[model samples]
Target: MKTINFTQMKDGTKEEYDFLAEMEKPYLSLTVDRVLTELKNQGEDSLSGYKITRLEHGLQSATRAYRDGADIDWVVGTLLHDVGDGLAPQNHDRFSAEVIRPFVRQEVAWVVEHHGIFQMYFYGHHYGWDKNAREEFKDHPCYQSCADFCERWDQSSFDPEYDFETLDFFTPMVRDVFSRKAYDPKVIKENQVFGLPEPIFHKLS
Candidate 1:
């Protein structure tokens, strides 16, 4: 493939920028494959010594959400809610939230972002933290939703014998979600309510 010749962004022609944007689409597609590979790799170990691998826990969470008639965003969010553990264990929820924020509803992203604190309601006491630590954000609109996510999907997902579906079963959904534009103008506009730059809409369009 012919590459742009300009060493500096200010020297690039419109044609070069256009070519780069078009090339980005294929690279975006590759990101989905890479994410899937990473998810599979996460199965090699149990989280915090849990019996099931993180992959199985993810599958179990997604399976439960699927059986409960959750939407694609919800199921996919459950599957990836902890995919950042390997790279961002101390603040995995934030990294995971950003990964799916572009592809999912804001509500789903909020649940993923705050699931760690919500999860503490179940076991934080073991680490000398308040079990009700999540209460600190009781006034947030998505508080109940995140609470439900931890209660029904995340905290309960460590079952080793559950008939959870395989990662293959959710592969198509993963591809479909990531295939969407990473920054839809409409979504960006809505996200402005949360402090994302309004100028991003023009930049994307």
Candidate 2:
């Protein structure tokens, strides 16, 4: 299996860890911490009646895609793609888009936006494919981007939001809405992860 590692920084001193060699994977420290903060607030179950937490779903979705043979970067993007949902529906996609834009290729950011397929269907499409959705979506720069990205989506598994209260995945990951927490200053340092470009948090604060 492929191996991953990390090096902690302490006052300009770096300490490295061979995670795979040590039987660990440390790629998602601060990245995941931020994602978890969002999950902690999602508070729901999946559409299949299974306990699919939003936070967990994002993590699991990434895992599912990976198991299905996606690359490492896609895995990370899928996992934290919806990190913005923890903020607000409209705002989250933009926030996540920015966060992932610099680090990944535009495609990754597109995936992050389309994770909210409902948003795409409603705002971007016209009951048809992207060609039909383009005009409406073109109204907003980000929404237009989502249209192109969503064109190649996997639609076999249906996601119904109407039953969200009863649908686990639609349910929030956390029971109560978490107070909008201030993001860490360190996030700025991640601006160049090669997936997400700008500070996705721009939509939040």
> In order, what lDDT does every prediction score?
0.82, 0.44
Candidate 2 minimal-lDDT segment of 10 residues? 196-205
- Model 2 bad stretches (over 4 Å): 1-32, 43-51, 114-131, 134-205
**Residue 121 CA displacement from its true place in model 1, Å:** 1.0
Candidate 2 structure quality by residue, lDDT tens digits, 1-205 = 2432434333221223333434433343344455455555664522245345555555554434444455444555655566676566567766776665555544555557655653445444465545343344444545533443233222211232212122243223211111222232332233233332221211111
Q: The CA-based lDDT of model 1 is what?
A: 0.82
Shift of residue 49 alpha carbon in model 2, Å: 10
> What's the count of clashing pairs in each model shown?
0, 28
> Which regions of candidate 1 are displaced past 4 Å?
45-48, 185-205
Question: How high is the lDDT of residue 64 in model 1?
Answer: 82
Q: lDDT per residue, candidate 1, 1-205, as tens digits? A: 3899899999999999999999888787798888898799888844767788888889999988887777788889899999898889899999999988998778788889999999999989999999998998898877878888887778988877678888999999998888877767554344322311111111111
